[model samples]
Target: MDAPSGIISAIVTGLVIGVLGRLVVPGRQAIGCLMTILVGLIGAAGGLAIANAIDAAWLLTLLLQIGVAAVLVLITASATGRNQ
Candidate 1:
């Protein structure tokens, strides 16, 4: 993908990853849509950075991404005082 396409792909992937992360966390989180997207984007970016450092396989990389996203969601929820 080119630059714009790559960015769009990242946003889309981030949205999905963020939603999946929220789902993984078993509780009602008070985060909004935009916040969710932002969290997901950050999580995905963080996860990819770590994955690059580790040079893991695709499956493990994916799991790590999702796991990282979940952690971010949890943190966001806690920070927002919505995780209870």
Candidate 2:
């Protein structure tokens, strides 16, 4: 199914947010571009869940998109010492 313009834009934004978020935490991701995009999408969804639980404001989704994902990457990297 084809996505609407808004959905497409959101996907692009999420992809960009994911790349930046990963970069925030030091590591060699060694993943493909597609994987990076996938990670970003997953991170955004996870962030949204946490944000919703914490009652983050509506306007901050994009920033929270990056922040939450970055925090997630940081936590995971610190814990595993490697991405699995």
Candidate 3:
């Protein structure tokens, strides 16, 4: 993929993963869209790295991504003192 498409893909993936992560969480989060996207991007990258290392399947990879995003969301919320 080219740079532009890769960037766009990353944003789209981040938005989806971020929303999924937020939904999976037990309660409402105090973070905004941008924070969620950032969390999602980091989570996706981390999850991909771990998945690659472990040779995880596609479903497992996605689950890992969402799980990582959820964890990050929790951390971010706590760090910001806005967990609700």
Candidate 4:
């Protein structure tokens, strides 16, 4: 897929991943739905960049985005936990 296609698909995929991430890494993030989507979007971009750097296949970027989003969610959850 081309750049635009990747981005479009990422947007859709990221939404699901974002919610899954939040549920997996539970905490009082208090993030609204829009904010969660934003975080997922950013995380997907970051993941894609890293994938490009490492010459990862296009299909892998999809997986990368989810993995990164999950990690970010987990980290954020842990951070909030520590703060409390």
Candidate 5:
């Protein structure tokens, strides 16, 4: 994919993954949309790395991505000291 399309796809994926991660986590998070998107981007990248290493299936890859995002959300919330 081209650079522009890749960036756009990443943003859209990040938004979906971030929201899904937030929904998976319990209670409220103190992070904002940008932070969530960042977390999602990182999580997606990490998950993809791990999945590639393990040769995981698509479903498992998605689950790993979501799981990573959830952990990131928790960590971010704790770091911000506003997880309720």
Candidate 6:
């Protein structure tokens, strides 16, 4: 894909991954949508980096991204004391 489309795809994928991460966690978090998106974006990039370094499969990479997102969400929620 072209640069713009690639970026767009990343954003979309990041959003989905972020939502999936949130869903995996139990209880309601007080974080906003924007914060969630940011977490997803960071998770996606970080997970992808590690996955790529290890030559992980596409599915594994996606799962890793979601996992990372979940961890990030948990960290943020705890740090902000949004949900205890």
Ten contiguous residues minimizing lDDT sum, candidate 5: 14-23
Clashing pairs in 6: none
Using lDDT as the measure, the top candidate is 5
> How high a TM-score does candidate 3 get?
0.95
In angstroms, give how far residue 57 of model 4 lies from its true place: 1.3
Model 6 scores a C-alpha lDDT of: 0.89
The number of clashing residue pairs in model 2 is 0
Candidate 1's residue-wise lDDT over 1-84, tens digit each? 689999899789989989988999998898989988888898888888888899988887777788899999999999989776
Off by over 4 Å in 5: none
**Candidate 5 TM-score to native:** 0.96
Q: When superposed on Cα atoms, how far off is each prediction in RMSD?
A: 1.4, 4.0, 0.8, 4.5, 0.7, 1.5
* Candidate 2 segments whose C-alpha is farther than 4 A from its true place: 58-64, 71-84
lDDT of 3 by residue, 1-84 (tens): 899999999999998899888888888898999999999999899899999999999999999999999999889988998878
Better of 3 and 4 by lDDT: 3
lDDT of 5 by residue, 27-46 (tens): 99989999999999998998
Better of 1 and 5 by lDDT: 5
How far in Å is the alpha carbon of 63 misplaced in model 4? Answer: 1.4
Best by TM-score: 5
Model 4, residue 1: C-alpha shift (Å): 15
What lDDT tens digits, residue by residue, belong to model 6 across residues 1-84?
A: 699999889788878878888988888888888888888999999889989999999999989999999999899899999894
Count of backbone clashes for each model?
A: 0, 0, 0, 0, 0, 0
| Pairs of residues at least 3 apart in sequence or in different chains that clash in candidate 3 | none
Residue 55 lDDT in candidate 3? 100
Question: TM-score ranking from best to worst?
Answer: 5, 3, 1, 6, 2, 4
